[model samples]
Structures are given as structure tokens and as C-alpha cells.
Target chain A: MDFALEVNKLCKAYKDTAFKLQNVSFNIPKGSIVGFVGKNGAGKSTTINAVLNILHKDSGEVAFFGKAMTDDAKYIRNDIGVVFDTVHFSGELTPKKLERVMKDIYENWDGALFLAYLERFHIPADKKIKTFSRGMTMKLSISSALSHKAKLLILDEATAGLDPVVREEILDLLLEFVENEENSILMSSHISSDLEKVADYIIFIDNGKIILSEKKDTLIYEYGIARMKQSDFDTLDKSEYLSARKRGLQLEVLIENKKQFTRAHPDIVTDNATIDEILPMLTKEESK
Target chain B: MKGLIRNDFYNVEGSMKLTMLAFIIIMIVLGIAGIYFPPNSYLASAVIGGTLGAFGALSGTAMQKDGASKWSRFELTMPISRSDVMKARYISFILYILIGLVMAIISALYFMR
Candidate 1:
């Protein structure tokens, strides 16, 4: 398949423990928003860092724009815009100073656009960054990232913990980026709600292993959560189930092919499960 | 590269103001308290060097802080090279150092007069 970014057989470990990212493999289609879903310490940040060459992967083949990332990481980086959850600027520097620094660094930095974003975000052009609030800091980083006209944006939990309004604004911006159909985004976020709004594809990882990767719409349609009696679940074919668990008097089952399963078993009431419900079951079943 | 350096230069917080002030005050104290002689090239050179060190330190710390910030991760994802990002902060430091030295030069000239 033609991919915008590919992580093939990627592996990494931190602090001499088990793998931080064990055999992670997935492809991000060009111009699509790929959501990276994982809990804390699930190797989401580590995966992003490896792609950016911030932390070296133990072994893997990463290709971007159909070129080997290891061989041409620097070249690939020029086209990727990265956004993280924390502020990256120094407390002392003003936006004006940061612009000057970035202009010299990025070959394609746009000073006018950066200034416009700062103004739109209501970030004071001359105020010290130390005084800026968390939301302001995030906005500042985004303004800087977008000004360079990046084709790929890698956002690591960029919207986590943000207010709904702020998160909505960011999601709109991400959607705007994807509207070009020449830009792709790989955003790693714990809040699946954020991704649900913007992601075209979803990759669910847990405890260093990737569990599921599929188009968001396909996942929503193909996989359904059914609450059935425990005895009823036993009567159904086990192969049709992605996962099943009993809680009190309720039995929840994640079906592999919800439409087909629904046709086969008309008696069962099938309902769509959110990404949050899908993740824990997928990861737990995979781990088991 | 050039843009990053420029950003660091005009930032104007501790790098430009506080550190510069501290450097100048220390230089003046050293010149007046113990070295009670008429100001000369030696005084100018010492003050400039001190001012450079002070501002240089501020910018250096700022660069490291930048590395840890959200911008660091964001910029890293872009096509720009990490080396370029790292280089921007250093160039910014050099700019701050020069700004401090300029102030020191003016102070030394005033003392000589």
C-alpha cells in the first residue's frame, strides 16, 4: 500500500525493562488523520520520539514519503510539523524573539503568518513567555508549527487535558489541515474523543504492542459491542468474538464483524462502542 | 537556523535584561571597590567579558529550556533538522552576549570620561 509514513517492525526499550514499543508496525496514509491511541507508558511518546529522531529506536524501518527515515531522517523532518502537550519555548523569550530564531532555523519559516497567529490567539507579541498560561503556551506552539506550512503534523497528546472549547478549536485546525488532501497528521492522544472528531484512521497500542489499526469509520461499523446474557454469549460462535467479559449480570462482547454477525444472529441487539470501550478490550485480549 | 537565532536574540526576558543588569552592576563594583584606578582598556575588556558571560549563560539555559518545551517536540516533527534547531539557540546566545557587551562598552567609555 502507498503510505505517507510507515513503521515496520519497530522496537524499543527503556531502562532495561521489557520493550517500551514491541514490534510496533502501522502505516499512515497520506493526507489522513491517523489517531494513535494508548494509555500512559504505552509507548506513544516513544514512538513519536523515534520518528523525530529524538530518541533512537533499537531497530526498525521508518519510511516517510516513501523514503527510508533512517537514511534521510533530516530530509523527512523538514516536511513534518510536530506538536507536543508541553510548552517548548523558554520562559524568557517573547514571541518576536522566537520568530527571529525560528526564521533562521526553518528553511521555510513564514514570519507574517506566525505574527498573524499570535495576534489571532491573543498572545502578546512582546510579553515574556513565562507569564503565559498553559492554553496560551499551546496556542503559541501551534501558531509556530502551522506558520511553516508543514505537510505532516505529529501531535503527541496535543489536546489532552484541554477544555472542550480549546480542544474543539484544535480539532478544527487539524481538520482544516486534512482538507488540503496533501497533508497528513499522526496525532497520539489519550482522549479518543478528540481523535473521534478528527481522525480518519486509528491505531490502538497498549503496553508497547499495537493491537488494532483500521479506518475509524470501518472500526465503528465493523465492530459493535453487544450486551448479552452469559448463556447467550456461550451459544454464539467463539470465533466471531473479538472479546467477551462478564460484569455482574451483564455480558459485553466485541464482535469482529458486527454487520455480518448481526445478520447471522438477528436476536442480539448490536450497538456501536466508542474508541474508549474498544481499546481496553482489544489490548486485554491481545495481551492474553 | 537564522530564524531560530533571531527569536532567541530579541526574546528580552532574563537573557537581555536581568542578566545584563547583574553583569553591569558586578563589573562596576569590581572596578570601583578594589581596582580604584582610572578606567582604561583593561576595564572595558573585563566588563565586556563579564557581560558576555552573564548573558551567554542566560541564553544557554534558555536554549535547554527550549529543548524541553512543547515547541521542541512540535518543531522536531517538522522537516527541519534537529541540528538546525539546536544551532538556532546557540546563535541566539551569541546575540545576547553581544547586546550585553555593547552596554558594557558604553559603561566603560563613560567611566573613562
Candidate 2:
């Protein structure tokens, strides 16, 4: 499979903080949207930054479009668009003025497409950016990112601080962007519901370590959460469960192979696990 | 590199405008004073110094805004190279200095005569 992005053994550490990204590796398939799910301070941003070379990695490899990202091959960045939570634009300049500045910067800037996005997003081209609301600012950032005719988009919490309606609109835009098989997106979000709606694959990270990376359908459909009596759980094979949590007289087990588990233990009941549930369940320390 | 330069200039556009206005006002006042006061050479230096100070302040303001907005985080993610980012900043800084130098030279020549 052709991958738009490939990361292997990525590691980063800060002097003042205990946080460290340990051996992070993942692949973003070409023409697919990969959702990066993690809690606050869970190293999602750190991993993304390392991949972009924003934070120099201690050790690891990151490749874009099959080319190793080295200081010599910096031109690969032209094909990638990026949107962050708090985007910095000149507050005094309007989107129109910003266009003039960006037009000089990007070789393939699509002025017509940018203006169309501004009109579609209802962004006033003449007003100072400071006057725009958070939603408008986000839209402006996305518009600029898209206007560059980038092949891949790297968004870090881009949906953050937007209302449901605005988020829905942005999600739709993302869907539209990937309609061409050449385009792809790697977005990080704490909002599992948004990922559930748009992502083809999901990668979950916790405490600077990747907990899981799987197809969205497999995680949603195959993974099962079983709640049962502790006495009955004692008889089940320990290897059958990925992780189990005990609550009062009952216990919840994360069955990796639900079909196999059910076939072996027909009396035990199993329920489907959502990404949100799977996140905490997998991240939570195993309690014996 | 051109994009980074444009971004930096765009970010500092308001400050640059204010700095230009201040320089113009100072030059006009100094020019009027030079006519009446027998072209005091110190006055020209003072005007140039004041304008340079204003430019410095404006640069500070722009830097503060950039820092506050966490722009480096966003900027590094773009297709531009890190060397290009550093080069853009240096070039912009040089541009600011060049603008100040021109104003000072023009003021000195005007007042010296």
C-alpha cells in the first residue's frame, strides 16, 4: 500500500519535563483520513510536531511521500497543509490583504479557490481578523491551508473551540477535500464523535505511547466489551482478554476477539465498544 | 522563503504603518525647526534617533504578537524549511534597519544643509 506518511521509531524528549514520545510509529495510507485520538498532554501534538520536524526528534525516522525527511529535502513540505488550534494571523490585516501576502509565498496558490472558500464560509474579506470570531478564524486558517493546493493536510485539534454546526461544516469540507484520491488528511482530535464520523483509520495515544492503531470499522465492530460476574471471569482464559477492569461485584473485559470469546463462552454477554470507551479502557492501568 | 517574509511583514503591517507615520511627523517637525534654528546638526541626529527608537518598539510589538499567538508551532508545520524561516526573520530585520537608515540619512542631509 502506498502511504502518504510513514513514521518509525520516532522519539522526542524535553529537558524540563518528564514527558517523552517513546518509539512512535504509524503509517497514514494514501487517500485515507487517519484520526489521531488522545487526551490532553497525551503526546499527540508532540508526535505530530516531531513528524513535521517542528520539534527535533531525539531518534527516529519520518518520511513524506516515501522520501526520508532530511534537512536537504525540505521541499516536500510544499505539499503539506497544516492547521493548529491557535492559528496566528495578523489581526490588523483582512483576509484580502492576507491573500496578497500568501500569493507571493506559495508557488501554486489558487486565488480563486481561496476567495470561493471565503465566500462559502461567509468570511468578510475586508474586516480586520481581530473582529472575526473563533469559528471564523478557524475557517480562515483552513481556507488558507486549502488554497495552497496541498496534497496532505496535517491538522492538530483543528476542530477545537468550534460549535457543533461549524465543526459539522468543517468535517464536510474535509470529506470534500479527500474526494480526489491524491488528497489525504491526518487530523488529531479529542472529540471521538468527530473522528467516528470521518476517519477511515484511528490511532490512539496515551502518555507519550501509542496504545492502538486500527481500522475504524474493526475497532467499532470487532472489539467487544464484556461485563460479567468476577467468579465467572476467573474461569475464562487470561489470554483471551486484552485488558479487564473490576468494578464492585462485576468486571469489564476488553475482548480482542469477540467472536472467538463468545463461541468459547456462550453464557458471557458482550457489547460493542465505542472509540471513546476503548480509549479509557485501554489507557487505564490494569487492575488485578 | 518569500512566503515567510510575506507572513512576517503581514504580521507587522500595522506596526510598520505606525512607525512610518511617526517618522514622517518627526521629520516634518525637525524640518520646520531646522528652518528657524539655523539647521542645528544635533536636531537631525535626535530626529533620526527617535525614528530608530520607534522602529525598535514596533519590532518588539510584532515579536510579542508572534510569540503570544504561538506562531512557531503553526509555522514549522508548513512546507517552508527552518533555514528559510530564520532567513526570513533576518531579512525582515535587515529591512527594518535599512528603512531606518534611509530616514536617518535623508534627515541628516536635510538638516546639515
Candidate 1's residue-wise lDDT over A1-288, tens digit each? Answer: 357788898888887776678889988888799999987888899888887677888898888788877523665666667777887776777888778767766667899999998887899998888889888888888888788778788888888778888778878888988898778899998888888878899998888888888889887777899888867887887788888776688788888688898888889888997899898777665211
Clashes of each: 32, 1
Q: Stretches of candidate 1 above 4 Å error?
A: A71-73, A286-288, B7-13, B26-56, B67-113
Question: What TM-score quantifies how close candidate 2 is to the native fold?
Answer: 0.93
lDDT of 2 by residue, A71-101 (tens): 5465687788888888567676689988887
- Write the residue-wise lDDT of candidate 2 on B1-84 in tens digits: 776677677778877887788778877886777677776656667777876776656556666767877775666666667687
Which has the greatest lDDT?
Answer: 2
lDDT at residue A161 of model 1 (Cα atoms): 71
The candidate 1 chain A region of ten consecutive residues with least summed lDDT is A279-288
Please state the error at residue A9 of candidate 2 in Å: 0.8
Clashes of 1: 32
- What is the Cα-based lDDT of residue A273 in candidate 1? 79
